[model samples]
Target: MHIKQATPALKAVAALLLTAALSSCGQSQNAGMPAAGPASVGVITLQPQDTVITRELPARISAFTVAEIRPQVGGIIQKRLFTEGSNVKAGQVLYQINPDTYQAAYQTAQASLAKAEATLTSADLKAKRYSQLVEIKAISSQDNDDARAALLQARADVATAKAAVETARINLAYTRITAPVSGRIGKSSVTAGALVTANQTTALATVQQLSTAYVDMTQSSTDLLRLRRDFAKGALQNQSGKAKVKLILEDGSEYAQPGELEFSDITVDSGTGMVTLRATFANPTGELLPGMFVRARLEQGVRHNALLVPQPAVSRNQKGEAVVMVVDRDNKVHARTIKTSQTIGDKWLVDGGLQGGERIVVEGLMKVQDGATVKPEPLKSNASAAK
Candidate 1:
């Protein structure tokens, strides 16, 4: 090799080049290596839980008892004993019809009864005399028989007079129209001086018992059948001995008192294909009125082992099917199509497509795609968030 003398400036330049080459090689190695681990996702572990499912159905408030006040005896209304739109008790006089005619009729019946009694007394004395005469042979047999028949006829007349008196008394009582039930009374259809007929088609007034009211709720026959089937299959349990119901007023405020499901009609409404269900609620304040629209929250049954998934974790795909992202044992994400029937609080009541013990992505869903590898991090439960 030839020995060449190099300058100090050239030697410094060579060192700089070598340093640059090493830096470039290190940068290339870093670029070829993996950037980071799989994306971390917040997930919830699926677990079977007991859930109480309730349905909200439209309902109408009805009075426990309804009475239409009608006149039993025809007469001119003399006075209205009760104030319109006020509470009245059973047997409280609501209207007073003219009793003058009834009183006269009653007096006439009494006079007739007195006359019959006088005749009966005379007939009894004559019959006794006839019996004695027939035994002593003092009177003819034909005369005694005639006397006995007259006595018997007199007794029948007395009985008939007594019945007439009773009828008159009943008619006099009917002059006053009283409430049949204790309840709030509506406006009077007939005022003072209005003539009313016996058993008139038009009512004088109406009274509705409101201390306790009924809520008539209609449910689809299909849904009712499904509930029955579920209960029969033991899929649902009646945790409460009786079904409990809550009322939502028309203004959207919940009624303070809860009610119990009374009974469901056996026959379905042919026109609507619905079953009529009734619930009884206390209306001490008279807040609930008849014909008022409301909603009833009815708890039909409880499911012991139900799979619930957070609502946020569920999404609808292009096909409008409900889907959830679940992590497999290999840490791979999969989009699962699920069947959801209803919402239990903030969770979707999953009917199918998920088994217990699967890790479902609840948060950080935007960062991961289906079939993507992910590192699942256990997320805090939000069970109470719905409430």
Candidate 2:
């Protein structure tokens, strides 16, 4: 019985060995065990770019010119000369006070002026007559002297009357209120028949010159200090030395126009440690308004001849430093640590750890390790394959 069992076991073992040998042979040829070469990978050719670094900051829209209109003379508004919310030019009549009152005063001034002129003429004639009388002794010396004194008094009274006329004319002219600036007028604070006071606490109306608007932004002092430090170290490049700024509205849409950095506050706020910046934009269409919130992009600097790589190619290592896989001329892949400033479009502005003309492993980063050999196809071809 033992010999019979052993014979069957041996047959089973031999069959198992034959099956293993056949499987090995098939795998070696068809299963890609020996004949297959290294797999192809996607890569990007490192190139230099004139990259600009910028900071996006929150901003608020402000009117370039703001005016609070108040009456200069206390009177009832007789007529609203300007339509509410209409554009007005400088010196344009905005409101007409009861011109009847002013006209009457003006006419009174004219009468006073005529009376003063008549008095002046009488004084001149009397003075000439007195001089002739004194020279010819046709009248007593005291009488001539008294006539001269009377003429002098009349001249002084005429001068005083003329001044009163001028004062009355000026007061009459102040009855009509006009716009001091060219701008879009706001709602009428005082309607027709409403009583308005001169330089009163209540404004007659508000006018905002929106032809050119201002976007006021603020940046942290820390960011400014960092930029200054980087500039000092020559790690960053600033085109035009100072950066140009642009705006994005609150709706996340970029403004149709661009703006320049007009001013940066020299003093930083003690509480917020922020420095204010202002950008001016032409708003001829009046699309921008005062107190509208928006975003401003301040172009802090530019990086000349920068080695750019896709953001996907960059990974953070254990120490939190950015690293990318680059293939050398021999197609040997190596992990290079890089210091990046910021992103421009789809790539990062590399500040260090990369030279121009290296093949950066953009797509096949996961497939290759440090010092691994790769067959790098053109990055464009790999991108197309992905799509």
State every prediction's TM-score relative to the real structure: 0.88, 0.77
Model 1 stretches with alpha carbons more than 4 Å out: 1-40, 382-387
Q: Write model 1 residue lDDT over 154-266, tens digit each, in one string.
A: 99999999999999999999998899999999999888999999999998899999999999999999999999899999989886577999999998899999999999999
Cα shift from native, residue 354, model 1 (Å):
1.2
lDDT of 1 at 28: 98
lDDT of 2: 0.82
| Top-scoring candidate (TM-score) | 1
Q: Worst lDDT window (10 residues) for model 2?
A: 378-387
Model 1 Cα RMSD, 1 decimal: 7.1
Candidate 2 local lDDT, 212-249, one digit each (tens): 99889999999889999978887677686445777888
Could you tell me which residue pairs clash in candidate 2? none
- lDDT of residue 127 for candidate 2: 78
